[model samples]
Target: MAEQTPDSLTSSITSRSTTRRAVVGVGLGAVALATAACSTSAGQQEEKQSQSEVTPLVDTRVAFYGKRQAGIDTPAQAHAVFIALDLCEGTNTQALIRLMRVLTADAAKLCAGEPSLVDQEPELAAVAANLTVTFGFGEKIFDIAAPAAKPQWLKPLPAFDEIDRLEDAWNDGDLLLQLCANDRMTLAHAQRTLLKGARPFVTVRWVQDGFLRAHGSEKPGETPRNLFGQVDGTVNPRQEDGTIDRYVWGENVEGLTPWVPGGTSLVIRRIHMNLDTWDLSDRPAREDAVGRKLSNGAPLTGEHEHDKADLEAVNELGFEVIAPYAHIRRAAPEKDIERILRRPYNYDLPVAAASGISQHGDTAGGISQSGLIFCSYQVDPLAQFVPIQRRLATLDMLNTWTVPIGSAVFALPPGCAPGQYIGQQLFEG
Candidate 1:
C-alpha cells in the first residue's frame, strides 16, 4: 500500500528514508521521557505530549476466525495451524518491548533491503508488501496481569450464541499474533525468524495459510477474489494519503483518546465458508445471492467488476436487479460508501484423521477451514464499521455460509521510533 504524494518520486523516497532514520534515533530517549513524565503528577501534560509524538511501530490490522465449518470435511482444511499463547507470568514490560523490536528488525532483514515487510506466501505477496502485525487478548487474561500493569483496550468481545468452541481457545491461551505480508516465502521467512525468539512468550495455537485475490486491474472497487472462488472484501476502506486520519484514526474528541495517532484500527474476522453447502446452491441462486458471476467478480448490473453497481436498476420482470439484501448492497456504508478499506487473505487447511474418520479421502479434506481473514481499518469502529457488519451478519444471504466464532479488539498505539518498544502507552499512567 504505497502512498502517492505530489512530490517527485526521487525526493519523496529520499525524504521518507531520512525521516525514518531520524525517528529511529529519537525514539528511545522519547520513551524514557514519557515514562518519567507520566510518573509525576505535575508532568502529566508533558507525558501526554510525549506519548502523542511517538509513532507506531507498525500499522496493524486485526484478523479473526469464525469456526463455521469446524466438523465438515472438505478440500480447504490442509492449511490450518492453531496458535495459542500463555501470558508471561511476572513478565517484564521491557521484555515485551524488546520482543517487538527484535521481530520488527527480523522482518526488515527478511525483506532484503526493502523497508516494507514481505509475506512469504506467494498468494499474499502483494498484500504483504504492506506489513501489518496484529494481536489481541481476552478479558479473563487481564485478571492475570499484575496489580499495577495491564495491556490497554484488552477485553472480551460480546459473546455470540452461535459458537461455543472459542471460549476454551480464549481462556486457555488468549493472545493471537497475525503477521500479514504479500509474499508467502517472505511470510514464512519472517514467521520462522519471529518464532525463534517468540517461542519463549508466545505459542502457536493454530496457524492457517490463506490467500486473497488482487483487486482485478480490470474491475475497480469490486469485491476481491479469494482462492475459494468467491469475491471477498467488497466494501473496504480506500487506502489513500491524507485519508488515514479519517479512516484509520477516529477523531480525538468526545472521550475517544486517539490510540494510534497516525495509524488506524484493524478489525479481522476469520470466517469459515461451508463450501459443501455453498457448492450445493445452484449457480443461478449463488449468482443471485452475490449479485454477480461466481466465475468472475463482475456485477450483474455490468459486465466488468469495476463497473458501477446499479442498486436500483430493474430486471426484465421489473424486479430490482441487485437483490436489496445482497452482500455488497448490505455491506456498503450508506453515508460514505468508500470509507472502509479491506485487505483480505484466504486460508485452506488440511484435515487430520481422528477417531471414526476414514483414511481414504481428499488429502486436503478433514475439516475444510478456508475462509477470509477479513481485515478492515477505520477511525471509528462504532460509526463506520459496525453498521455495515451488523447488517451483513443479520441479513446478508452469505451469512448462511459464513459464521462468526472468534473475535477480539485492541487499541493500537502510534508507531515508536527505533530503540523504543511498541505499546509504550500501556505503562504510562
Candidate 2:
C-alpha cells in the first residue's frame, strides 16, 4: 500500500460509504482522518490496520520550534513538572541573554533525542518520549529587561474570598520552566540539563509536579480522569481547530506587547482538595457537586459525557437538577467569548508528622496538602479568567472541599524558530 494524501484518503473512504471526518494540522501537511461504520466487519478491519501502525512511545518527538509553544497546544504528556525560579542577586541583561541561549540550544538537542552539550549520561536522552520544554516570563524578567514597559496585568493576582491561605513559597517567581514527557527519566534528564546551565544565574523558587495515566494505559484521546475520578479537560480547544487565534493569542498582531505575538498568559493555582471529606460524600452527592455522573462524567440531565448540560432542567420538586452551585454550573460561561482553555493536573504530597498535621481537616480547614495544579491559558486572563473565577469565589459549592493555596501568573512567549531562543523577540524585537 502507498502513503495516501489527505485528499486521496477522504476520496477513498467515501468509496466505502463509511462516514469520515478530516482535521488538517496547520503547517503539518497531515490530516487526522477518522472513520466510522455501522458494520462490525468494517470496524474490525480498521482496528486491525491501526494496530499494525501504532506509534511507539519512545519514537514520538515534539518539535521545540513553532508559532506557538509546543506544550501549550500539544496533548498533555504522562508526566510533568512546573518549576519557578528567581534571578541571582547581580544577574543582568547579558547574563539573562546567555541563559536563554543555552536553554534554547539544550532544549533543541534534548527534544530531538540528542544528549545535552554537558550531559553526563548521554543514554538518558535515547528516548525523547515526546518531551517538551516551555519557558515563561514573570514580572521580574521584564523589570530586568525594561521596567518601564511591563504589561499592566503582569502583577500579583488580587486576593479572592475563596482563598483561605496563599503560601508564598509556591505563589510567584521571576521565571518558569514547564517540563513534560511520557517518561519521568527522560523528563528528569532534560530538566537537570537545563537547570544546570541556568544555575549560576538563578535559584529554584518552587516546584509543582503532577501526572496522568501513562501512554498505552488507555485510549490515546480519552480525557484523563483526575484523582477525584472525574474526567478532566473535556472542553479544551483542539490544536488544529484554528480557533487559537481568538482564544489564546492576544491581538494576533506582531509586537502588540513587546514581541508578544502568538504568546499567551498562564494562570497557575494550587487548589488543595480534601479527599478524606470528599470520600464521606455518597456517589450521588459527589456527582451532584460536579454536575456530572460519577461513572461516565455525563451531566445529570444527559446520558453522555459530551452531552450539553441542561442547566435549566428540574425534578419533581422544581429544584435545579444540575444544582444551583454545582461546579460546572457556576463555571460555565454564559457568553461565547468567556471561555478559557484549561490544562490541569493532580498533585499529592504527604503532610509530615513533624509539622504536627492531622488527617480530618474538613472543608473550611486545610487538607493534608494534596491538590490540583489548576492551570489555564488565555489571550487575556483579565477578560477570560477573572470574571468566571470571581463568580466561583463567591458561592461555588465545590469551594467547600477545595482551597486555593498557591497562585501565580506568567507570560508564555511565542515559540522560537530554528537557532532562535524561546524569548528571543523580547530582547531583540
Could you estimate the TM-score for every candidate? 0.62, 0.83
The 10-residue segment of model 2 with minimum total lDDT is: 19-28
lDDT of each: 0.47, 0.75
112: Cα error in model 2, Å: 0.9
lDDT of 2 by residue, 1-429 (tens): 222221232233333322111111221222123333334444555555544444555666787777777777666778889999999988777888999999889988888888988899999997887788988899988888766646677877778965457878789899999988888889889989989988989999999988888754555556788888888777665545655556767543232232267788888988888776777788888888889987887899999888999999999999999999898998888666566778788887765542433244342233456678888887767777887888888878788678888899998888888878887777665
Residue 183 lDDT in model 1?
Answer: 39
**What is model 1's C-alpha RMSD?**
18.0
Residue-level lDDT tens digits of model 1 in 10-124: 2433444445445544555465666665545434544454444432212211111111100011111112222345556665545565655665454434333232343343333
Top candidate on lDDT is: 2
**Candidate 1: which stretches are off by over 4 Å?**
1-84, 112-154, 160-176, 213-224, 240-245, 251-257, 335-339, 353-367, 425-429
* CA error at residue 32 for candidate 2, angstroms: 34
Highest-TM-score candidate: 2
lDDT of residue 265 for candidate 2 = 85
